[model samples]
Target: MKATLILVGTELLSGGMIDTNSLYMAEELNKYGIEIGSKITVKDKIEDIINAITYGKENSDLIIMSGGLGPTIDDITKEAIAKYLNKKLVVDQDELNELKEKFRERNLKFIEINTKEVEKPEGSVTFKNGAGMAPAVYIDGIVCFPGVPIELYDMFPKFLKWYSEEKKLKSDEILIKDLITYGIAESLLDNKISDIFTEEGIDYEFLVKDFGIIIRLQSKISNKNIVEKIVEKIYNRVGDNIFGEDSDRLEKLIIKSLKEKGKTLSVAESCTGGLLSDSFVNVSGASEVFMEGIVTYSNDAKIKRLGVKKETLEKFGAVSEETAREMVLGLKTDVGISVTGIAGPLGGTKEKPVGLVYMGIRNGNEVEVEKKVFKGSRRKVRERAVLHSLFCLNKMLKRK
Candidate 1:
């Protein structure tokens, strides 16, 4: 099966809001072996919506649209869809009554404008939105969803189930595996594993993302044995640089490893602020292994909070390896990590340029500090610093 995605919103074009719905939709559809042929973003105007739908219908078997489903006047997705399909709009009384009951349950007044939320194209199938006011409607091979990300996420599973049954889709045709790797350049990674792409019935692509490089291997035949052989070859070539597989996060893996090994960790941050700590805490069950974290943004905080000596800051500055080592050593845990960097468009000197980072990892009596220089904006530098810290920590954890 093939699909086309339409994202309709003036805010998306004007940079007022990001369009995240399409990515989620594409990934979910791909799980069912539905190929996304194209994705179009258009303004909230009816003409643009109709044109996009026309293109979708011409090129793909399924058309999925999101946005402009609110009660406001500018919300015209359903109107354009009805116009394109030559259908009349009608109010679904059951949906309207349910929406009103929901509003009343929350002790909120039901405004007259909200009635527009239940108006679907005549003879179309409608699915109630469990997370929001608008209902998703399917008409003439197109599915309409509210632009709000949470609502689309909540309602996508129901749509997917209905769609698979209606189309009698077999999901075992295409299979994809994603290998996430860090601490290696894309060109170097390609040099190591590029030869394996010549195997029959398999396709490959490399994606350069902010965090790392993703090696996506797809098999058209869905032969598990061939896919596993190719994966084994790639692993043999790439080795430890391949940190995790599909949907595996480095922070979450670190937390899980710590729990398995019966270890606790703490962190101190400088230019990275609290981002490193935030990543660890975002994982569930982190409390079992995460002991404490402190953001010593100032020299005084480093000296007072983490017990760094005044002399060390004066001699080597706060962004030096000496300061990072002291910061990690001061923390009382089975493992301690520290990051200090100069992430800047300013506050850079000849000796300490922007993106110069020092990361320290201390496990037991052993400690190591690494100096790295990265390139990008301030946020990029800070994010890279955090990723580097996690990579180094992972290496330490693998040690005997």
Candidate 2:
């Protein structure tokens, strides 16, 4: 089914904020096999909002409108929908009492703002306000929701069932799995896997980037069983190199890998400066596999913590392959991963250029070190170093 998205905010139109809500909704709708035909943004004006709804009704099977649903004078989404549908705005007694009750329970003063929230367009279905004061409104195939991220997240997912019941949206089946890979461009992965898709006739897509790759697959069919079978068939073929599945990041994958393999990890960071450690520890169960992390940004700290040789720092500087190797191997953890680099606008000589990075991984008695030169701004350089460290560590983890 075709859909339209209308975002209302002067701030968004003037580039004061990015319109990420539309981006998120578009992708979510696509997963339901519902194509978005048009998207537009307007100021918090009644006529503009009404015109957008009018246009959407004429063109699309469904329309989703966000913003202008807050409890303020500028909150006009409900009013605009009422005008477009030629309906009266009447207070729903149930919702009005709810607002007052919540205020009373919290010992806060209630105002006309509470009454304003219950003013629904005539003959509109008011979806419950689990996440916010602004209740969702559904009228004539149009679903309007609040702009708040938390509220939208809670409310929009329920739209799947709502649409299926109300609009008779077909439950088209698609099973998707993602594998995150690095050290490759989107074009290159497409080159490697494009031929497979052609020969097998199994639909697949690649989300490629300098950060990493996420290979996704979904059957262009309506049967859940058949769609899932193709996903399994494809996964078996792309096995070990598939570090992550279903958009899980390197940290989550590593944690799972370590947990399954009964191994543990540690980090020694210089240029990456504990980013690697943070990535792992962010996951809920990472403590099961993450032993510790050491941020040795200085040469003296590296020597003291990871036992890098004082002479190595004097001869090759802090950002060198030799130093990285020493740092990784010298770590007391079972698996020691390290990164050292010149993430810089300054601090580079002719011999040691900016964006020069060295990464090291130590497993048992073996130490592997690799060096590369990245070109970017200071922050960009740091980001690249952190990404590369994760990528390399991911590969090594798989090999073990």
Maximum-TM-score candidate: 1
lDDT value, residue 150 of candidate 2: 77
Using all chains and alpha carbons, the TM-scores for the candidates as numbered come to 0.96, 0.86
Locate the minimum summed-lDDT window of 10 residues in model 2. 193-202
Estimate candidate 2's alpha-carbon lDDT, on a 0 to 1 scale: 0.79
Each prediction's whole-model lDDT (CA): 0.90, 0.79
Question: What is the RMSD of candidate 2?
Answer: 3.3
> Candidate 1 lDDT, tens digit per residue, 186-247?
99999999988887777799988766799998876557788888899989999789888998
